[model samples]
Target chain A: EDQVTQSPEALRLQEGESSSLNCSYTVSGLRGLFWYRQDPGKGPEFLFTLYSAGEEKEKERLKATLTKKESFLHITAPKPEDSATYLCAVQGMGKTSYDKVIFGPGTSLSVIP
Target chain B: GAGVSQSPSNKVTEKGKDVELRCDPISGHTALYWYRQSLGQGLEFLIYFQGNSAPDKSGLPSDRFSAERTGGSVSTLTIQRTQQEDSAVYLCASSQRGVRGSNQPQHFGDGTRLSIL
Candidate 1:
């Protein structure tokens, strides 16, 4: 079965403290790996989509990197506004006509000033 | 709409009552998806609509859950005989299309929070 797991279920960091959130996955024929940020009472906001190993994408203080087995979301100098649940999803080729995305239990990050 | 839109921002109803949630996909988007998120959990896929047809419904938890899309633009999810366990945030998302191996990331809407009392 295709599955996704994220580490450090919850993390509290001081402002300007850099850290990384891990997302590990096992899937059949990985097609794309996605990163999203979801705040309370709001749907997830798209971040980066990594298609292959060694691929990396950046936006502001966030960076996403992918490998064959896992993906990492590195947050640098995070601010209180950056606190949210970071979600990781994997889209894989499957027998169904449409591809299915498996999402990991998100990492809740809190940045305190 | 400029982005994917969902109706009934919040719903509170007695158990066993049916509820209908609506979604309006972005213009020109040919793919729509419905997912349910429980407290502190990841999205649980419910259905996927490619154009006006749903090609995948296996993710639905039970027969009480059903959904449909009309005119390839609007969709509805109907939950029958709702139970307390059905309480969750229902999310709608859309992509350019449901092509294989495409890089289109789904755009999401602020979801509808359903509370079955």
Candidate 2:
């Protein structure tokens, strides 16, 4: 089975504070690792997809990097608007031909002004 | 031009009642997925459909939950004899293709918040 674990279940930071969220996973074969941001009452928005180790992707104030067993989402100078839940998921090897993805509990981020 | 869309943005129904949630995927997307999210939680994959093929219902919690995609465009998820545990937000997402390892990003809808009273 594919399992994902996220750290610091909840994080509180003041505006301009920087922090990093961790996502570790164990699966048969890691096809892809995805990072999403979900706000209250809305669906998750895709952030980045890291496929291999030592790979990195950045968007605005957020940067996502992946290793062999885990991935990191670093937030730089967070703002109040960045308050949301950060989710990590992994696409696992399939038995037949179909692919299945598993998600973590997520990191709830709160940036206060 | 339009993103994925879902119907009944919010629903409140008594226990044992049946509810149907609708989802319309992006115009030409071939893969559609249904997921459930509880309060302060991450997404729980429920089902996935690739074109008109048999849907992968492995993630479905129970037999009471079922979904169908029609005309290769719209999809519906039905819950029978709903329980309080069923109250959560249902989300729908669509991607372009799944075959040959494509980097298709799943575009999601706003989601339907169901409250079982």
Candidate 3:
């Protein structure tokens, strides 16, 4: 079965502290790997999409890198405003899973000042 | 342009009551999807629509859940005899094209929070 898993379910980091969130997946064949940010009381917002291993995408202080078995979301000098639940999702190219993206449980990061 | 829109930002009701949630996808988006997010859980895919047709309903938890799209723009998800377990944030999303390797990312709405007592 196709599955996505994220580690460090909850992380508390001081302001300006850098950290990395992990998203590991097992699938038949990967079509895309997506990263999303979700704040409390709201839906998730798109961040980046990585199509293959060794690919990378960045936005502001966030960078996403992909590998054959996992993806990493690295936060650099995060601010209080950057605190939110980071979500990772993967889409498989198989017949039973091609139409939907399987999402991970998410990592809740708290950047305290 | 408006992203996706959903009605009744919050709903509170008793068990066994039927409820309806609505979604309006992006003006030109041909694909729509519905998902459920329980407290602390990941977003769960509930259904998918291509225009006015639903090609997948396997994600729905029970027979009491049903959804339909009209005019290829507005969609509704109806749940009958709602239970406490049905309470969750219902999210609606849309993409430019089909989800199968289309590389079209989904845009989401704020979502409707349902609380069944």
Best by lDDT: 3
Please give, for residues A12-89, the per-residue lDDT of candidate 1 as tens digits.
Answer: 999999999999999887889999999999989999989899999999999999999999999999999999999999
Best by DockQ: 3
lDDT tens string, model 3, A14-94? 999999999999988888899999999988999998989999999999999999999999999999999999999988878
Candidate 3 residue-wise lDDT, B1-117, digit = tens: 588999889999999999999999989988888999999999999998875554588799999999998888899999999999999999999887634546477889999999999
Candidate 1 residue pairs in clash (backbone atoms < 3 Å): none
Residue-wise lDDT of candidate 2 within B1-117, one digit each (tens)?
A: 499999999999999999999999999998889999988877899998987778899899999999999988999999999999999999999888544374366778999999999
Cα-lDDT of candidate 2: 0.90
Docking quality tier of model 3: medium
**Candidate 3 segments exceeding 4 Å error:** B52-54, B98-103
What are the C-alpha RMSDs, in order, of all predicted structures?
A: 1.5, 1.5, 1.6
Interface RMSD of each: 1.4, 1.8, 1.2
What DockQ would candidate 2 receive versus the native complex? 0.63
- Better candidate number, 2 or 3, judged by DockQ: 3
Ranking of models by DockQ: 3, 1, 2
User: Cα deviation of B9 in candidate 1 (Å)?
Assistant: 0.4
TM-score of chain B of 3: 0.93
